[model samples]
Target: MPSEVVVEKQKLKNPPLDLRYLGDRALRQPAKRVAKVDQELRLLAKEMLQTMYTADGIGLAAPQVAVQKQVIVIDCEPDNPANPPLILVNPVIKQLSSQLCVMQEGCLSIPGVYLDVVRPQVAEISYKDENGRPRTLKANELLARCIQHEIDHLNGVLFVDRVENKIALNAELSKHGFSAKAVKPIA
Candidate 1:
């Protein structure tokens, strides 16, 4: 006779984030609801920070968590203890330049897949900080790219959508042993 077996399921410390699909239904238009930087958003920010840290990610957008609001959390200064993680609400990329740079990028949504993507090297963004005070920031380098990437997600654009060359994207996907069968166009 086999010994009696018992198993217990452990709850996830941080629930997995939801990645929105690109479509009319998924396209989150500019929200007029005006998200308040209240306790819920704060808690969400905290969870996102925890999730990002767990995943070793530099930034995360609200859309990645199934929140259809313009929110983002970033901790690009990972080495700096003095600089805490930032939470932006109703973020808007107010200004962008023509200059572009390409960087190999990966997404937490589509795990284990990386591809080169071209984005503006710098951008001026205006958003309400965690305190709900309007703030303007001029970001460059990796920070700029991250902000652009997250903001794009709020507007229903994926990094794959910004791939300058599909062949290159597909090649990279193939190299990683992932299929590019479900590639969606930026709607």
Candidate 2:
């Protein structure tokens, strides 16, 4: 079963969470595993979804809001009201596909800097739902990408760090007024 916690899929003028930007120290620290899932955590998850929607983002991580918990909210199809957003707590990557794909990726933290990143086409993940029920998800395509991207936030990685093309990465970051030095390449 999917997450039962639901929020209005609409943008709020004053979102509850204040998103931390790309170079923020909060975004650089690895998130702590959720010690316990409770009403307080669920409320934070709701605010996370609200902030993600308000920023027109498909995915969001707790660290993006300076929350040190292992939580993420994802709604790949925000336009579809029937689709409920996913709320993941203490998420862990169980597996990743060997097949890689390159797609244009953007981040709410990075704002206007959209760059190409190479990531696995499929991912198997395990997480706790808003109800604290353990769940497994095998996601592919956009959902897979979104999951991996948000999970990276848990590990203190930005999509820019996974970008292979240094030239393009530098240009994109510079154009967006972000220093290239802030990018710590994965490999």
lDDT of each: 0.70, 0.93
The regions of model 2 sitting more than 4 angstroms off are 1-4
TM-score quality measure for candidate 2: 0.97
The residue-by-residue lDDT of candidate 1 on 1-187, one tens digit each, is 2211111122235644544443334534443335577767666676666666666677888777677777788878655655677678888889988999888887766566677887889999999876677889999988899898888777766787767778877887677665566565464
lDDT of predicted model 1? 0.70
What C-alpha RMSD separates each model from the true structure? Answer: 10.0, 1.1
Candidate 2 worst ten-residue window by lDDT:
1-10
Q: Tell me the lDDT of model 2 at 119.
A: 92
Backbone clash tally (model 1) = 0
Please give the lDDT score for candidate 2: 0.93
Each candidate's TM vs. the true structure? Answer: 0.79, 0.97
What is the Å distance of residue 5 in model 2 from its true position? Answer: 2.1
